[model samples]
Target: MAEVEEVLSHPLNNTDEAIKGTVKLVATPVGTALAYGSLVFMALLPIFYGALRSVRCAKSKNSSDMPETITSRDAARFPLIASCTLFGLYLFFKIFSQEYINLLLSMYFFLLGILALSHTLSPAMNRFFPVNFPNKQYQLLFTQDTGETKEEIVNYEFDTKDMVCLAFSSVVGVWYLLKKHWIANNLFGLAFALNGVELLHLNNVSTGCILLGGLFIYDVFWVFGTNVMVTVAKSFEAPIKLVFPQDLLEHGLEANNFAMLGLGDIVIPGIFIALLLRFDISLKKNTHTYFYTSFFAYIFGLALTIFVMHTFKHAQPALLYLVPACIGFPLLIALVKGEIAEMFRYEESPKEVSGDSNQEKKESEKKEN
Candidate 1:
């Protein structure tokens, strides 16, 4: 039990040591509650819708005939690529000096935060401004001194909404950059993560299962099996992780001591939530059973994560609890409904897209014949 406790405490201990005495606990439960609420709001609502729109646009661009959820082949291969990319980034961050890393990360967080926050406002903005505005083409040509070469730039003019969104984002980014306030930092991270979860997509149940299963083991191995994840989580300090105040016991600490849930904890579960939402739409059901069930499961899982963390006095791998809750609850519901097989076999089919692809294929085949 002592050994297990030590493992659980690894993340918090390292983070405390890393931050030094700069922070102390504020109002523990209240702060944490607010943080949890923020995460859920971003995961289920604005952030999610934004992600759906982006995915649809991307798929439409790739092949108008492609399915809304993408193909299983694509879904299955996503994790390997993501894992490799994350590991590589971890290595770079691990090797770089803190000063240099902060410099690079500053720009990245600023730009990404702007995009996330601005995109979140789009739906609301659409209500005030027209969804689609007329486009105007602008051409700019750059000529060398001798007029040897000319390059033309053609682009759509930024209209009322575009300028408003852009202006709003720029102001927010600039304010964060200059202020570097803790609240802004946390909010920026939330926006960026919300956008990420919103934009990510999955093809089907099997894909969500594959993703959650692989990450479940990955989270356990990293948090419990090795020191690497905790170490990385501690050493790296940026808005990529959301910090909630947790040490209310300390005197005069308004927001110093904090509990953190990294973007991974939020996004991994969020993607599954987004998947269920898409699934809800695909079924044409008047109600949203799977989506709501999964959403609540996430709430339960996160609560469990916090409970275990406080109970054990250590850092818990969130995905360890989250994976089972998110995946298991829905499966149980389906089984109870006598729809297990149907759920397992569920695949999104857009017949219009299929017809378009077939037509394209026939046209090419005729030319060949």
Candidate 2:
């Protein structure tokens, strides 16, 4: 998730200008409520959609398509990596031309956004394909060695439906690249957030805690301790964050007054909530208590962030509000239910699960013999 920053004016066309001071937003109470409410609603959509998709992926037998899971160590190190990346971009803006940097970023995200959007649409697009459509299957394989020693480096399977999806996504990508429209930007942003939550797995509850906890500090420090995060956010023109026009009622579709929320705020806590959904599945209780609790907590936290930001007219670190709510709500539920130990012990590792299944099969065969 990138740092969430609200911008008052259109993105600067010239990068050579000095960093401007924050501009105040003046709007009616109803307009303010509507803008913030819409933001909260938009934020929830991706998290829920992504978490559900992640659960399906986790339960799927095929491991080829599953994204790499994040371990405790990776979670611990994420904040540091993010910090470096944030600070590095800040320095790059200082040393180099912002226009050139943003141009490169736009091109990079243009490609990435196309792929992500295509992937996000793949499942739905498959259903919509005409029955008579020539949906030929395709596989991409890259291997090394020979015969028994051959190692498969990459193996991806797709079909014509996927190609169609990619083509559609590319059109949207072009629109975003050329116009930088908020709706086009959001299409890419939502796809990115959905993919992030769906693919990035936390091994267990503890790892999720480590990640959310670390990011909480990272978001707070970068946002408040220094102006690095805000500076990069203002200069960086990419579809990395979701923006809502605050003055939509007044300016309509051409509105430039925008309120932005970083993808990080959605994806980071989202993975944890998804993990709880998985944990609920593992219990085989047909209940989604933990998942729902955390999901609602995320909404509450984000709403709180907006309220406080509105009241103080300052850029507030969303994670400061989100992290505690997401973690605490579920944890409190677990504690009250006397499932704290069980919650901590629950973990999901594909390799280990497969190995154990294989071992059990072998033992059963031996016993039968």
Candidate 3:
């Protein structure tokens, strides 16, 4: 396999320790399964959540807080482009970073993620923060194409609950900064995973497939054909990947050897699954055949990835198995039901997804009045 020339230098390129951690975990079947299960849960939970929220919003009067789906063919390319760029950037930084800037960058993201991921905790947190409390708004000025500039405001209110979450998460970052604890590493990892699933949107099945196909090849070449993926994965110390303690039950906490899964493996397949869920909601007939089928297929595919890695004692590209399973099962179901054409025709419109049809009409009436 071809290896990336280590063009830069970093202390985390401690290849000896990384190989030690990853190599022996294969022998522990229970640990391997446990780690894979935790990863799968984190990955799919947000997709399931967003999809459920999408269905609920479709039935409701307002969904302004819900995410809007993209409709333009050009717009759909953004996520794929962003993913590729980020992947390359991560590899570059991983091979360098003498000052450990990635952790600092991760700290900023973790702060934002704590707020975004804790929305479910908001209702209870509201007892402390309250809705009527003063809100803080930050503004950014953007220059438009027509020699005009517009200011956009983002509203956020920091309260007791937000403070506590932020303080505790900051403490975790500090711990990571000083000691490089797995606890802090995993916390940021989970938060980033949850944030991506919550915020990112894939426009449609066609867009999802395009992204997945490109990434599928990317993953295979890096993982199997080249040594770059494994080399970077071993060396990069950031939380771009999830790490779960494998020997917690047997060897206790001291056995810090972990089973790892990269975020790319999770997020790439997840967006496609979310698209399928929305497609099910759009059917408007209360059937979830495609959605549920794809969900379980994900479990099966992840299981196969782990099984093969353990059996062959090789680092496997998860998307090789995952893309086919996630995309294929749902397509097969649609084919069987003779809804393949309808499935292909399905698209998510922002107005429809956000339940904004009535809201737009109300705004128009105010203008006319």
lDDT of each: 0.61, 0.82, 0.61
Greater TM-score among 1 and 3 belongs to 3
Best by TM-score: 2
CA lDDT, candidate 3, residue 182: 69
lDDT of prediction 1:
0.61
User: Please, what are the lDDT tens digits per residue for candidate 1 over residues 1-369?
Assistant: 000101112223244443332333334566556655554454445335544654464345223213245355654565566556556556876787866877776787788778667666655676776546753433334434453253323323334565577678778788777766556666676675656565555656888888778777777866767556666666554566765444434433354555566777676677777777666666687767887898789878877876786565556788888889999999998899887887777664455555676578668878998
lDDT of 3: 0.61
Which residue ranges in model 2 land beyond 4 Å of their true spot? 1-23, 353-369
What digit string (tens of lDDT, one per residue) describes model 3 on residues 105-209?
556555554544454343345577656776454333344345224322432444456555566566766676666666666666655554455455666777777
Superposing all C-alpha atoms, what RMSD in Å does each candidate have to the true structure? 7.8, 4.4, 6.3
Superposition error at 342 for model 1 (Å): 2.2
Report the lDDT tens digits of candidate 2 across residue range 192-259: 98888888889999999998999888988987798787787777899888887767788888886667
TM-score of each: 0.72, 0.90, 0.74
Order the candidate numbers by TM-score, best to worst: 2, 3, 1
Off by over 4 Å in 1: 1-94, 128-158, 247-254, 349-369
Best by lDDT: 2
